[model samples]
Target: MKFNWEGVMPAVTTKFTKDDKLDLKMFQTNIKAQVDAGVHGIVLGGTLGEASTLLESEKRQLTKSTLEVVEGKIPVLMNIAEQSTKGAIYAAQQAQQDGASGLMILPPMRYKSGDRETVTYFKEVAKNTDLPIMIYNNPVDYKIEVTLDMFDEMLECKNIQAVKESTRDTTNITRIINKFGTRLKIMTGVDTIALESLLMGADGWVAGLVCAFPAETVAIYELQKAGRIKEAIEIYRWFLPLLELDINPKLVQNIKLAEVYTNIGTENVRAPRLPLFGDERKNVIQIIESSLKTRPTLPAYKNL
Candidate 1:
């Protein structure tokens, strides 16, 4: 599968059974729903996917399972959040060997690296893999900004093709475009501002909330692309509250709860991250339930 580096690619959650095992069956079901809803691609093992908690073997298993489900219709990308250049390179190579279409590689985790070190890390990983890479430029949470100047350094690596623009500034989208032109595909990484980012000329969205509401997420992107701004805005306004859930520290729990309500997934997350309980659970459920009640009928977007 060729990586297009565009459109709504869900930073999907890794599903688990009560026993904390990989629930590949439920994973497949949710992925099938994403496919049925016409998503552009599937990204596995990211922040939402609990990449930190997953063992190397588990990540490989998730990648292989995802490839099986998506088949060849859409690309399945693995997220590389390793802390070392060697580990990142190994993870990149493993993803390639396991049949990942591309990679969403973060800068060195745990220990924050400065501009020079960060650029070197990304360049090193790109050198090791033939797969196209999306640099996760999430300075707010990750504490390392992959600046335009850094991108200048990375230009020689042809495989470093995209940026997951999670900087939370919509203007950064335009800045990226102005600086690089089509050299780097800019996919907006924040959920709450996704439509805003798309409207601002972002090439696509690396969405989080799409794990539960795939169709609505895809519809927002398609409608915006189709020039149906009025319709897209209406749906986006409805989706705003739910979209806010993706930014919280407890996002995995929040989104898995949304999935539970949507009947697409369970709330069984990995350990050290338990399912939401008490008022936290209730509050999240309130948002999910409220949104579900007035869930807008998606207009025909396929022909758009």
Candidate 2:
């Protein structure tokens, strides 16, 4: 099925219990809240969801719970990234069966490899399912960059459709738009450059901060879509500092804490990934609190 993918697809956080178990109830509540707030889609199992730390079972459960909450109201894109091609394909097929609208596949991690290896990896995974696939290009995390040429090659797969452009370079965004705008649906994965990406002809944004502030994120996109540039910039300036905080190494910790402070989701995160503590923790708290205090009044939630 060809789905029209667009707008503020949050790389949602997976809510965990205090002991770091997957908190399914909290996860459902969070997804329900985003759907109610009118986001275009929910992107579970992505970087912000802490997908790397989740087990295969947990990934399946998250997709199941998300399907229940969203109730077919909006599209769901599951991020299936693993060190092994087989694992990624397994996860993608499971998510597709569980009613996910599409799969966002990341390059295999843990081994430093060349472009041919990376292309082979994605091709293997793509062959496994008929679900629409979005190539997630985040070079910083995966240590592999899928260039424009590689993207063109992948487009021949037909089911390999959209792209989540996470690189912070607008030039690359322009290059992709210039080359493949007609063939692919490009979405900005970087929160800071989301507006610029949209202005440069990207179809939508896959934002991380939308987990904390969905209304504001949606407003920015809607305003831009309506050609209300001045108004969108005004909201963007107010929210940019909070978006900046998301680019830190301690992002998951900060985002979870912000969710807790906003009474949206739990502050719990799994280990190997720990909560922010001491001065580092304090600095994130201070920034979020300050943002909340200075946070511009979004139009009535009804107006949104």
Best by lDDT: 1
Tens digits of lDDT, candidate 2, 91-119: 87888788788888888878876888888
lDDT of each: 0.92, 0.84
Candidate 1 off by > 4 Å:
none
Total backbone collisions for each predicted model = 0, 0
Q: Each model's RMSD to truth, in Å?
A: 1.0, 1.6
Worst 10 residues of 2 by lDDT: 295-304
lDDT at position 186, candidate 2:
87
lDDT of 1 by residue, 86-121 (tens): 999999999999999999999999998989999999
After the best TM-score superposition of candidate 2, give how far the Cα of residue 167 lies from its true spot, in angstroms: 1.5
TM-score of each: 0.98, 0.96
User: Model 1, residue 279: what's the lDDT?
Assistant: 95
Of the candidates shown, which would achieve the greatest TM-score relative to the real structure? Answer: 1
- Model 1, position 118, has a per-residue lDDT of 94
Candidate 2 segments exceeding 4 Å error = 300-304
